[model samples]
Target: MKQKLIFFIAIAICFSSCENKEKNQSVILKGSIQNSNDSVLIFYYSDKSDTVFLSGKNDFRFVLDLKMPVYGYFRINKKTINVFLSPGDSLELKADANRLEEITFSGIGADENKCLSQLSEERTKQEINYEEWFSLDEKQFVFKSDSAYKAQLIFLENLQHKFNNLNPFFTKTEKARIFYTYAESRIAYERSQVFSANSKQKLSPAFYSFQKEINLNDSTMVFIPEYQIFLKTYLDKKVYEQEKNYETMNDLIGAEFDIILSEIKQQQIKNYLLHSVFRDHLQFNGLEGAKDLLALYEKHTTNKKNKDEISSLVKKWQQLLPGNSAPEIALQDELGKIHSLKDFKGKYVFIDFWATWCYPCRREIPHLAKLHKEYSGKNIVFISISIDKQKEAWEQMLKIEKMPWLQLHTTPDAKLLQDYQIYSIPRFVLIDKEGKIVNAQAPAPSEKKLRDMLDMAL
Candidate 1:
């Protein structure tokens, strides 16, 4: 009797384990790619992202725990494939790295994915020729957009019909995407007419009838890429309607933020716009006058993620501010000799961050050469740091150009680039004689402002 009872308890425990395992099964996105050169694939969903590293054999997988179905996209290098993921989905994908457009799906969610692929391809075929569309009059533009919208909507409906088991969330969001895309084009047309062409002819009331359909306060649609774009265009239209004259770019940004705070009531939309405005400001002007605006942003926005990101950027920018000691830069020369910025401490330093592959950087070469020749006798040193991954290309270019300034090579991921916040090529920096930063984002070698700044510093 004791042995039988123990056996019964073991069977009950096994059953319980099986039940828990079934309940805990989340989304399993596994894939294999042939001839893939990338190290990782990025999957983005609902403002969150997950990365799966490719194995030695180029197989990858991501197990995601999701509460509801969401429309997301997988990005490998420059190629993006849309996907619909739901709880309990166990989807598998197969693709050739060279031909990502031909990716195939299997297992659960296969029908919806195949349909999405068709939808993407069809939409591409129906994409508007913006140049041609812009040349048309308001009436013609509206007619063209309306026709396109109708065709796309029909295509989506057909996809839903074909894929009988399509997720409702995916269907709803796809429909929203089609509509928002049309609305964005309409807004773009209106802006072109009013601002670019300066057209005074009153447009027909029917032209803007679509605006009535736009719910500016809707927070549920924030994750849709099309809706996000439409919101931006809509915000620009609202801001431009109020005032167009601004002395500076930051002034324009400030006006945008004011409109966002005062007009937008939805918490999510308001937070998104606020974060966007501040980020743009930071990108363009770097941390100048950003503290006050940041304080206001912290006061208004409840999004801890965006707030933390902005705060982190602010701290990084603080290190690059004028009068602060310049970030240490150590790079190797053509002969593999390490050169430090501190080696030229007694002289003012003008750095030109360039690459052999950058057309704009090459274009500035002659202008930089002229400055170097002119300032050869001055208390300053001109240095060209080549941010090229292939050292051979940089060395070959150096041999061809025979640039007179100190030629150095550094990889793209160097600490020097991050420390100085060098996002783009052909960047210039000016350092004082005492190793202090005069301007982290100094004027270019071709600019008269650079000459003036140098003269004043000397």
Candidate 2:
């Protein structure tokens, strides 16, 4: 009797274990790539990244624990596959490695993914060229933008209804995704119309109705790319609308803070915008009148982590203040000539860290040329280092532009990056003739103060 009872207990325990295992099974994302064998593949979303090696037949697979629906990036070398993912999805794909964009999906969420694919195809075919868009009248522009947004909204509504039974949460997130995109279209339409209108043809009241619908404090949408962009657009518009209220730049910054604190109710969103504004102000203008802003952030924000992170950045910026020895950089010139920061020791170096793809960086090139010409015989050197991954493209651009300053290229990830904490590009660093950093975070070539600083350095 004792042995039989022990056997029954063992079976019950085994059954319980099996049930738990079945319940814990994750969302599976597996696929195979045809043509060209690449050893490594990468999958990324938001702040998370995962890397895996390919099989002999270019087959790849990923098992993920997903709590909510989101977009993810699947990459094979330089090629990328954008995908929509959700729980209980056993997603499968067979794609051509050379044409990563063209893919077919199968399994649980196959139908929804197909809809996304259709939209992607539509976007590629329907996107208006920049010059073509600018040529359109305000009415035409508004119609085009509105139509695009409306069509996407209709599609999203139908999709949500179809998938509502599967997961209401998933459908809601999908709606948010589409809504994020709609925000971009809305902003673009209004901006184009506003730019063309004369003083008497004031429009904002007509085209900006959608702005009132958005919840400024919704941090839940932070993970969406379009949502992040929308926040930037919204905040920028707020600054422009209230520009007349503030007289000086410092006053403007203070007003921006007040607006954010008053309008944004979520701690996370406030913390993000506060940290962003503070960091950017520090980056461009240095620490002048910024201590007050930092104190304001500390007083208003309740997020400990965000406060700590900004505090750390504040300390780092302090270290990068004027008169500090510039971080050492080693790079090669266009003709396979190796050089170091020390090579330009005798002359004042107007060090510009830029990339070919950056529009602001390209815009500053003309200013740099003008400055170089003006100070041609002076004791200064204008050196631009490109952080471009493609050497051929960089060379082509330089040849096409005929830049009059020293041009050099470095790999995308370099030691120079770590030493300088250079987060954004088109950054200018003014190093003294004695090889010491005069302004570690110097003004841009286009800034009027840049010339004054350079004159003082010389």
Candidate 3:
């Protein structure tokens, strides 16, 4: 009986100790912003976000329950500052909205936060002359890049020496950031060389020796932005090297998705890369040829959250499939007259979702005009809808271009944009005479395919 009683007491004590440990792990972040225009502050930690409303005095507080150390950011108005937080950290931050770079920190986690702020300032200085750096020859770039990385490492090391109690996670993640940032710059050199000079200069094998140092499947560094960027650059280089005679860019894109799915062994890293690929594919290429990649993604990815999100996105795009009733959007013409797809129900509609700021949309105007003239008195109509937030800019563009066809305007946040899944500008949609979608993602006017499609429709 005494042994049983002692066992129960021991179990109770263990539970109590665990509960206290968890409570101590909670992070208390309180901050104040001076001369701020925004009422709310956002803290982004990995994939999670916490929004806190600022008080009348422009002060805010966030109590984050965390099991481990994390690198996060505090977004104040248009500017964001880096923050490194650990379990039991109680940090106080102060900044002026106009001068976020001069942010100050205090309290338990103050040293690390201050270090991150200083490091960010140094990174900005390094990138300030990026175009000049990118213009350097391979040898010059390597020398410059190596020197910059060495300086960054020395700077971080000096800070670590200054702050003796800095968390090991912060130091480790900072080192990873420095390493990946250098790696990304090295990988990007080839692209810059190719695009800037339009020359396919053969790079020596020694140029890419940095690639040997990379662990492509580092799941621990997945949340670090620099590491994410390096992985993307590395994958892009790999795809470029492996490119063969392909029928279309879509074929290359499809192969790229397959490469990410097959080559990346780390589950979290795979999830991030796959999610990015799908989102980019959907935005630029639309739903065409996305199914195979989606199926592969579903098979490979074990993240339920990412899987659910991708599934939701796929469902949204599915609504824009051919033969579906065209999404009804209320638009206004130059004179503020309302119009809908129903107004042109008996005419084949070639809709242009564009903005005045879109250069591609401007380039397509001549081709669109020619098509309108050729199809005059035919059973089709060309409609250009401006998604420019500034109504005056849309009106000014219509007047200057003197486009003969129908001109209309809608806000960027219009439900029509959402329904059409219009994330990019210069998006073209084709509707049959009966108001059913012929193609939600139609070929651009500049393409021969568009003329062929129109001829077939007519």
- Top TM-score prediction, candidate number: 3
Q: Candidate 1: list runs displaced more than 4 Å.
A: 1-25, 38-42, 52-60, 195-202, 332-339, 354-370, 385-415, 445-448
lDDT of 3 by residue, 115-192 (tens): 998888888887625688887778888889999999999999999998898888889889989999988888787878
Model 1 pairs whose backbones collide: none
TM-score of each: 0.83, 0.75, 0.91
Candidate 3 — what's its lDDT? 0.86
* Number of the candidate with higher TM-score, 2 or 3: 3
Winner on lDDT (2 vs 3): 3
* lDDT score for candidate 2 against the true structure: 0.75
Question: Best to worst by TM-score, what's the order?
Answer: 3, 1, 2
Which lDDT tens digits does candidate 2 get at residues 114-217?
76676666656656465565456656656776787678767766665664454555456556656666666666645655565542344546666666668777
